[model samples]
Target: MDSPSSSTGPQPIVNSRPGGRRRSILSDFLSDSLPQPSSFLSTSPGIAREILTQDIAECSSSDDDDEQAAASDAESASGPADAKLAFHPNGIVWGAGCSLVPTHSRDRPVPNPHEVEESLHAELSLLRDNAILPPKHRRPRTTNAFARLYRRNFSTKVRDHEGPIVPDVAVETTPMLREIPPTPGPEEIERRFEFAVAHHEIRTTWQREAKTLIQYSTPLIATFLMHYSVTIGSVLTVGRLGLVELAAVNLATMTASITCYVPVQGLATCLDTLCAQAYGSGHKHLVGLQAQRMTWLLWILMVPIALLWWFSEPILAALVPSKETASLAATFLRVLIAGMPGVAMLESGKRFVQSQGLFKATTYALMMGAPLSFLQNWLFVFKFGWGFVGAAAAMAITQNLLPLLLVLYVWLVDGSRCWNGFSRKALRNWGPMIKLALPGMIMIEAQFSVLEVLTLCAGQFGTSQLAAQSILVTVTSTSFNIPFPLAIATSTRVANLIGADLSQAAKVTAKVSIIAACMVGCFNLLLFTTFRDLLPRIFTDDVEVIRIASQALLVCGVMQVFDAIAAVAHGLLRGIGQQAIGSYANLFSYYLVALPISLSTAFALGWRLTGLWAGITVGLLCVSVIELAYLHQTDWEVAAAQAADRLRSEDVAEVKLRRHSHSSYHMEV
Candidate 1:
């Protein structure tokens, strides 16, 4: 939300400095808060109406007779003016019945292990005093169900969630025009366009796509936090059990997560994008059909997945170093994997619902899952004699319970029946889905592979290094997610636009997404740059790890823009069903290029961790650059023609099939 500013003295009173030298707190806060004072102050005079009444009251409380004595309180309250904001130290600027948070502070300082614990007491008090979210809404949102569980017992409903919660809007919204032009005058339209462009450039310099950045990047942050939450619990419970338990738990989680999730997530995007497209095109059946296929596919996948669950220990042994690890990983993996069906169902169901613009379902499901997962984890790991295995079981058990119920819940609501009547066309829709899906899968695989190598490399440095790497990885992952939700939203928009025959608008939306990503990337770059030294202390006190992690942050931090570009490019293409291209880019970048280079550098060249990180840089940079270039060179008109051609081909294929009176694959399975 802010960066440390040089002191701006308090506002001038009647007896204050004669030269107006005591700069108003306004100078500290607003001067820094506004993108450009000249434009923002008058650009939208009504903005003052939108200030949070609570924040205003908090600010207005400054009339406390001893306000001057609490100037530090004032400064702290007004910290958004100058002090650099991180996720923990949220800053707000309040005065004159208004509050300003220059940005959603993305820098999450890794807390020392005890700091979070200490905060728990205060958090508990708040919980005791404050109101809970509506009982129906009290559960965590779907995307975050598992993680939210960690905070359930310790957390209160009192603290506001950091992200912008999309409240249910009952007002009718049917694609209304959203243009709010700069205060217009005799200014030429073209000139006005130029001016708007220039103004955007300047303001965006300090702020990225603040909203979008926060949206997409929150997942990454959540990922980082997830590692910590799991690690904190595991380490506390398992650390005393010895290194073997720790290693076993880690290995078990990794193998299952990589095998279970990475590919699944990539493949699931098809549902997200296609469903969005179908919804946009008003082809209701496609959305439901795709969801059914995905659900059935999960069922099919579950057979093999459950087998692995049955044999999880051996798999852990194969992947990790120790027999003890094998035993530990296997024990945990089995339980966790048992929950795999639920996890898959939950995710797929969410994508289905989210695609159909029923975002509430996903949120509601998460709300339920969070506390349940946490309580389960606690009981199994701590109360039961399960150790790391118990922790894993907790996760699995809760996971297992959620999905089937959700499926049935939706079905009971007539969702399942909605897909009952499948047209013959519904029986034959796999080709395009797979074609558009592979690239995303490839990218996910490539990324997970990179992470595996990096984790392995970090292993050589010892546990502290691994923990630090995990910490930073979590931070960046979480930060990067700032744009991801936006990317998802953008994908939906792109599908809608493309479906509606607005190719140019689709292109514009893609461009808008990229620009938004870059701006977010830039702001985050600034955040990491400013807080590089501060972030390492959050995880551990090991001085060597801090120094090493800080250096890694420096090198890796600058590449976020490239990552942003690459990710959004992939998202855009996939939305248009050009997934294989992005997949290929990912494959080439990570496998044919980054892997070899980074491995050789880290191991062969003796560059150590730097080499490992450099590889990620090279791969991501190459991917981003080449992908952007490809996007730039895209001939959408030709592509649009090709879309029509493909549809024509499908039509012909359908006609031939009907003419031949061929049977379908519906009976095969």
Candidate 2:
């Protein structure tokens, strides 16, 4: 009796795949596996099981012409012994049933039904397959056929990520997502709300955190372009004025990049990390108030930024003996000053929105802002009498004012209620904001200050070498900064995961992002090396400018690997909320080590641009090596431990819910 059962058992088993003899058990599988409620659990258990069991094969095939190709393809589900279907983790079809690549199919026969096998990957009849009775109960169907079972993962994909908990009320609906519990403290709610409202000010600020970050970071690559192109174009326009004028531009830009631009980037990044955690937690009042605080703080920073422009004339006059150079430098400062307030606001507003997770909008702003700035530069410098001053002014008008105004208008117009809530009360709880935002700000501010010392030290090398350094640094920064957006994406994604208490998922995402950055590094290195000589010509027509720039670029060629690693680490830090440590690391490595090393090499060792770039390389290398090592060894367990805490707090509620529902009703024990 058992012999026949073994011999004939697999005949229907082979036919169990979708569209294979329309097995009745398919309905039961559908009912059991499709995430239905208890009420409907019994209604169509058999029918549900049958449909689902057979649905894989039952899913419609390709159009007439494509079916053969799909059927005959070595990786298709129905391929022969020599030709197995490629198995995709995401299933065979993503959209419209188009077969995806890289699937794995096996040639094994189905196991005997009554005999149980024990392997995670082993295929046995699940609810849907086992629901229907044997041949004794069913109408006769084909008997001996291939019983090779397609392995099905019967368990639901349990959520692997938990976003940061806040006043956990409503969350954006996502697949297999677990709801974040509301923050435990009433104070947290108020603080978060204030920050959101401040950043979302309808008429004044109104930027979401995510969108703002994207807007600012997306421009990083473009700014690198601006530094290089303007340096080149400015050199040409200053041709009649002489090398001193060109050198003035290099020095001013160096000062700006290190002191104003990059630090501002780091400082505003405070908004990115703090606002995100605060907002994700959904303490609405805190968001509004905190955003205002951040805004005002950055506003005060404008004093120094403006002072940099105002005092620029005298500084250049003292640094360079050339009268024309000093005069031109003063003029550049005036124009930069006019735009300084707006630039700072734009950065501030942008970060406020980005911290809320609006990356798409932020990127769009850059798409709009870059072209306008470039256009103004051409019009003011080349088309008008202003020359370098005109170009510089144009950049200010396009980049500084435009980005600020647009982002501000968006926040004000759309997020009006969010704007009106600012007050001193929101500032009262300084602890969390300081804990989250200050570390990042210090890290960024210190990073820029160090870069400033290095660049200024290089300025002593004269216009050509400084100009070459600027161009080389600009290129390397721009090329590798392409990974910045991905990093931002990674950080936010990981933060949400961490908040959701999904440590494993956070790790995977971080690893993938690092991998992506390294790949980008490879491409950048190749690009710089392949076009090393020609790359500089795009920035300047002067033979000397191009010559020195090329040599620096050649050395800068291999710098991408380290740069990519460091940048990604910075992003990972932001994501994991390790802002202070990263800040400390930047301060320690760049200032304590790289800057001094570069200074010694350039001045003491008699190296010029090579020594300067070598310093940058060494600084970044030190930062990268230490940062990456820390990132790899990060103790994700602390985050995992949060799960136990969550359970300790929320699990009791779940039990009470079950008990309450059970007590008040006729439900059985």
Q: How do all models score by TM-score? A: 0.55, 0.58
lDDT of 2 at 139: 17
Q: Supply the TM-score for candidate 1.
A: 0.55
Off by over 4 Å in 2: 1-242, 262-293, 320-326, 355-357, 404-413, 421-439, 642-669
Candidate 1 achieves a global lDDT of 0.48
> For residues 183-212, what per-residue lDDT tens digits would candidate 1 score against the true structure?
322223224323432332111111112333
lDDT of 2 by residue, 1-669 (tens): 111122113221112244322222113212322321111001111221122112212222213212322322223222111101111101001100000001111111111111111110111111112221111122122222221110111111111011111232344445434333332232333333234323421110011122323443455445334333433444444443445556666666666655666555555544543443233222223335556665666667778778777877777667655556567767776777776666566665654544333323444555566566666666676677677777567656755655564465557543332343446553344444444444444544556565456556656766677656556655664565466544544554455444334454455455556666678778888898889888776666668877887777766766676677666666666555564455566667777877777788889998777776677777777777666665544555354344335434433543443244323322321
Q: Using TM-score as the measure, which candidate wins? A: 2
Each model's number of backbone clashes?
Answer: 28, 83
Question: To one decimal, what is the Cα RMSD in angstroms of model 1 from the true structure?
Answer: 21.6
Off by over 4 Å in 1: 1-249, 266-327, 351-357, 382-386, 408-447, 460-464, 498-508, 529-551, 575-577, 640-669
